[model samples]
Target chain A: MSKPETPPAPSCSQLFWVFTRIALTSFGGGVSGWLLREFVQNRKWMTQEEFLNGLSISQALPGVNVKNMAVWIGYRLLGWRGAIVGFVGIIVPPAIIIVLLGTIFSSLSRYALTHVALTGAAAAAVGLSLSMGITAARAVPRKAVPIAIMAGTFIAVALLHWPLFWVVLAAGLVSVAYAYARAS
Target chain B: MSEIPHTSLLLSLLAVFAPLSLVTIGGGQSAIADINRQVVDVQWLSQAQFVDAFAISRMAPGPGSLLVTLIGWQVAGFWGAVVATLAIFGPTTFLIYAVAHMWSRNGGARWKRALETGLRPVAAGMILASTYVLLQAIDGGWFARAVALASTATLLLTKVNPLLLIGAGVVIFVGLHAISLA
Candidate 1:
């Protein structure tokens, strides 16, 4: 297959600054969608097709999707330098915010407002997590073996109270064997 | 600002980050189950404390997993939080960079596609498991259970902002408290 010629790379500094801006603003949900809108749709740094491809690759690889996506976007915009700047840019804001909050939070634990707010937020965390789970579940390919694995893992961890390590290890081994067997 | 011991802070940071970085194959929530083990079961933090940190993380702007910083702080202090947050994300960030670089170069290929196919279901399963574990940890009472169930329903049925739902839960809880309803 003929390799497509790479486009002119953006400067590392440009990539760094762009990602820094995005990281600063990407609070709460919708960060990924926002990145898609800005980088792919509006800026045309990468085509929609390329963005989707990159998203899948990022999700498959370890790490947060937003951070991974940032790295990929930076690399696409530049190269190795782009990757470093993008990673650092995405990570730094959250790190700083959490540290600051941590300091205040320890002191404010006795405050009524903080206590009530945290309790409520905990309830909502469950909802957010369930929503995430539902969304992820929809993405599972309609296959018997995979579905079975999903159900089994859920039951094992949720109902059986099996240690997570054992459950994950078993599922991983089974999935790998199944994939290899099918391939052969 | 009290000086946090660097060695204890560094050790705790590594203890939290090493397992979290390696095992968070799916993403933020996927790390929760392991985090529960390390933080709660290991007595690094109590279950309620974990809930508090998680709540704060959810309410705050940024990645959900960024709550790890708060957990780090609880284990050590300000510097500990910073170190743990950095350590947790550092290797994973580099790994993502390397993988993204190779992936862009290769473009769409069979192996990549196969990996995606395998990982998607696994990630889904991990998310479900994490949700279950969280629900168990937050086992309060009928009121709490009702709130959780209602919140889950609202999330599934409506497009309301999560922060708003969180606010509603707080209002209801406070109302109950004020009225001497426990």
Candidate 2:
């Protein structure tokens, strides 16, 4: 199969800088939305179809979805060097900032106001998470089998407090197997 | 607290997080519970500290999984933070590369469709579950919960910037507290 060559491919540094910008500026979640707008819309380095495919696979695979996506997008555009840049760019800069912020917040943790402010910040953050959850919930097919699988997964992890590994394994296997069988 | 050797802490942080990487199934967030359990069970940090770390990561720019880096820093120091970042993100790097390689090579293959189609609902469920866990652990009582709901509504309804909403939350909470005092 001939690859649809993307003109004006990004170099490792370009990939790093682009991903770094996305990582730093993307806050309160929706990193994927940011990625789409940057790479597909503004840059045109990758098409929308290609980007969405990478996102789906990224979400399906293990590890951080956004991190996985960076690698997938990088690999699609620039091969080996691009992949390395994606991994480093996404993980390193953010890790540094988080550690620094952790330091600052630790000092502030002593104050009642810090706790209060952080509480408000956190409350708002939880809203982002909840909204995301609502979006995810709405995405599921209304079919009974899929709905049941979704509910079962929620119960095992959220309510029963089963270990994530077992729950993912059992649920993922059953769901994937069902999908494969249905497709066949 | 027993003084764990530097090497021992690094190795254990690597051990705990590396394996969790594979089972991260949907995304980094899905592993939060096991992370919570293992870190606490291993006596690396207290529950309150972990909750604080979660909040800091959520507020910080970048992926929320940076909580691991903060955890590592709290547990040991700079090197610990580096090691933890590598541990969590490093392990899955190759797996994704290989999958991406094959995915682009194969294009719309059976397993690809199966993996994509099959995992969608599972991913959604895990995300929802993580949100549930976070809600259960949050502080500030009903006010926080209400703040969360209003934030959700605003996100769903308006195109308002999330950073602004977060700032608004801070103001609302502080304002309400002042009114109570008066």
Candidate 3:
């Protein structure tokens, strides 16, 4: 299939810096949203439909959605080097910051307020997790089998204290198989 | 814990995170429960330390899965962080990259749709379960739980900045602490 290429891809360094800025500037959630704005809205690197297609695949596949989206976008534009640049740019800088923060907090671990502040932050962080859970739950189809699988997964992992690996494997296989059968 | 050799510690980090990488269906958040379980079992981090790492990861920018990196740093410093980060993120990079190559092709549309829709329920369940585990793991009493619930409500109901919510949480707790001290 011959494809027309218009406008050259950004240099690998440019791609790296773009991803780095996105990663460093993103606070709280919504990294994917930032990706959409930068790539589709501002840069016009890809169309909205193309980005959304990558977004869905990114979400469905195992891995972090934002990171997957980065790789997908990078690959779409610049091939292998772009993908590698995207992955490293998004992951490395903030990783160093996390370590630094962890060091600073560990030093202050002796203070009573340190624990208290962390506790507060953690409490709020749980909301982040819970909100994501609720959103995911709402997206599930309103049907019996899928709902049952979801409930069962919750039970096995949370209540029963079963190993998450086995629980995810079993539930995922069953659910995917069902969906596949239905689609046939 | 100190008696464990350096190479073994790195290897252990790999063993724990690499497998969990592929199974992280929805996101890195989905694997937290297992990460918590394994880290605790190995005595790499106490529950409190794990929770602290979780909070720090939340507060830090970039991917939340960097929680694994923080865990590694806490456990064995720089080398630990390096191993853990690579383990958690590396496996899935290959998986997603390969998929991206094939995704442009028109074949296997039905299977692709099935995989996407089928995984949604399981991902939802895992995320909720992880939330349940975290809610239980937190050390703060009712007040903390209340704050978490309030944050969740706020997030769902409004488009407020989560950083603001977290700051409010800190102020509320510290302020209440000051009153109790007085």
Best by DockQ: 3
Compose the digit string of candidate 2's lDDT tens values, residues A1-184.
6676667887788889999998998776788999999898888899888898889888888889889999999898889888889988888898889988999989987876776677777788778777877777787778888789889988998899888777888889999998888777
* Candidate 3 global TM-score: 0.96
TM-scores for chain B, listed for all candidates: 0.89, 0.86, 0.95
The CAPRI quality class of candidate 1 comes to medium
DockQ of the two-chain complex in candidate 2: 0.69
Candidate 2 local Cα displacement, residue A54, angstroms: 1.1
lDDT of 1 by residue, B1-182 (tens): 65866696578668667656654656777777768767786687887788878877777666777878788777877776777777667767778777766765664465665667666677788788888778777735666767877888888898777778887877877676667744
User: What is the Cα-based lDDT of residue B138 in candidate 1?
Assistant: 73
Give the interface RMSD values of the models in order.
2.4, 1.5, 0.9
What is the lDDT of every predicted structure here?
A: 0.73, 0.83, 0.90
lDDT of 3 by residue, B1-182 (tens): 24334898889899999999888989888999889989998899999989889989998999999999999888887888889999999999998899889889768978988999999999999999999999999977888899999999999999888888888887887788878899
lDDT, residue A47, candidate 1: 77
What are the TM-scores, per candidate, against the unseen true structure? 0.87, 0.92, 0.96
Docking class of 2: medium
Over 4 Å off in model 2, which ranges?
A: A1-6, B1-5, B177-182
Off by over 4 Å in 1: A1-14, A159-170, A176-184, B1-9
Error of 2 at A78 (Å): 2.0
